[model samples]
Target: MVDLMEHAGANPGRGTYGMAMAASRTVFEARRDCAALLGVKDPRDLFFVSGCTEACNLMLKGLLQPGDRVVVSSMEHNAVTRPLHVLSGRGVRVDFVTADTAGLVDAEAFERAVAEAPTRAIVCQHASNVTGTIQPIGDLADIAHAAGALMLVDGAQGAGHLDVDVAALDVDAYACSGHKALLGPQGIGVLYLRSGLDAMQLVEGGTGASGADEPGQPLDRPERYEAGTPNTPGIAGLGAAARYQSAHGAGIRATERRLTVRLREALSAMDDVVLLGPAPHDESVPVVSFTSPRAEPDRIAFELDRRFGIAVRSGLHCAPWAHRTIGTLDTGALRIGIGHGTTDADIDALLAGLDEVLA
Candidate 1:
């Protein structure tokens, strides 16, 4: 990979200070490139935040008023739902856009939710954290626009796993974490905002630029949203990660699908094992979730870790609505997420462990 960098325009020898400056610039360009990847035109419209959680809070606080109503799907991550729930405590009216049993947001229902008067914004997750069920963002964006509402999409699980076009989708805001699919370090995230969209700053501090005001925060891209000192190392790594994804993302997507389909087929073949979310798992990412009739989700997770050295996530995944939709509300479901680096051997390891547990 280091040898490949010579041709890629990223030099490791660019000194610590030079590298730091490069990362700052890369962070700016990454926001643009990521926006382009998501189908948004201007890079200046994007903001680099701490992570998806802060991005959600920024949108929620920046867009909504005291009496405004906000709509969110039941399948959204706590990053999206929890912030709105907090706002509801402050007298903001928050309504839910229902999801089907498979954990998908009903497009019509979401549209209707946005149509109601006094609705300030519609927040939706691009995919479910627990079930990996994909939503209809383009159509939902259309509906939200028709209702004069801004659409905020949580892309924590979708940005790297799936294709997104912000301009075509007509979304007002899209938030994503850098670690998950983009393969960057933790504490870095990208938020794409449509031109002319103004989100209130969640915090006010030093942005390292344009701080003549007494309150001390620049009202500009990458500055207005970024307070205090930025994470230069993580941002540099993120630039590398973005370049990696751009070069190999298509192949990664195909590989994840192939592995996920094989694993899903194997899970479906098990007699007592029940697959959760969509059947055939077509529109979702490389996430496969299920429950066993004989065991609890937590025990299943523990057994996989202790007995087979397999790492998988369990519990509600902070998306309670998705767990409820899949009939795993009480116990949640065992989840396996296949990333770009996941291999066939990894899938086989999980399958063999699951089969052993069921037996």
Candidate 2:
């Protein structure tokens, strides 16, 4: 990856036919690797974007027209909510299906939301970023399709951590961040669109050539959505990360799950601590959230970092609706995320830090 960046930096004129062909091959290979990771058959169905936020925006803005009705889950990150909020301002009616205290969105509530209105799409997260709850996306997609609404999943927290098969879920659109569970470089994201879905292009610019004078006459498939110069270095890094994850994802996931269970069990044992989301050993990603009755979440996070050399995310985590659903809107929780590299010693250190801080 570094070698490619160095080469591209030295020879800036990668726009030449030969150089362009090389670049195209690299980008397509990256796309193919990402698609394989997501269980997508065709690499062309996936489009690279700046990040998952942009990918979510492209799917939301590209699919829904003005005044279209969309149903979303309450556990969605701001990536889905903020765009829907913006679309709502433009006459799109957005309705939310509330989740239970376990951070699981009720399928019945989603069905009711879809049945109540003329829904165009159902937007949801495959897993809650704040609480690590894995949603029932397959059932939700079934309900959406039965109601004649498209199902869109934000897989930012789910992919690379969980076994994600877009075909099995039957979703129309899936968005994921390369930097999150994928352990890739920042600023790169992937969006997978179901075959035959005509999503209006969100951004338009030079896409090689189409032999048409009109700027609107863009190229087909991946080229149609990808405009301007691509992020070659970031894409290369993402591809490398995808390859790594593909090779050792099972072992990584097992380690993460074990650490998550240990952390959740320790926190739940604390009398003053309020553990959020599912039970200690539920089916979820390796994310644990909790709040202390006597200490502020930010203060706890600060103390942990300063006193114990531990880092954690605090507050709403860009999902106010998730907090609201879990009854933490007034006081956001402290979040500890486990990754592929998180060790048992790291989990022990965090638990010890929490004990000291709370005491």
Best by lDDT: 2
**34-119 per-residue lDDT for model 1 (tens digits):** 66666768777877778888777887877787798888888877887788888888888988877887888888887766666667
Deviation (Å) of 248 in candidate 2? 0.8
Relative to the true structure, candidate 1 reaches a TM of: 0.91
Q: When superposed on Cα atoms, how far off is each prediction in RMSD?
A: 3.8, 1.7
Global lDDT of each candidate: 0.78, 0.89
* Alpha-carbon RMSD, candidate 1: 3.8
Per-model TM-score, in order, reads: 0.91, 0.96
Instruction: Give the range where candidate 2 is weakest over 10 consecutive residues by summed lDDT.
Output: 6-15
In candidate 2, stretches whose alpha carbon ends up further than 4 angstroms from where it belongs are: 9-19, 212-214, 217-219
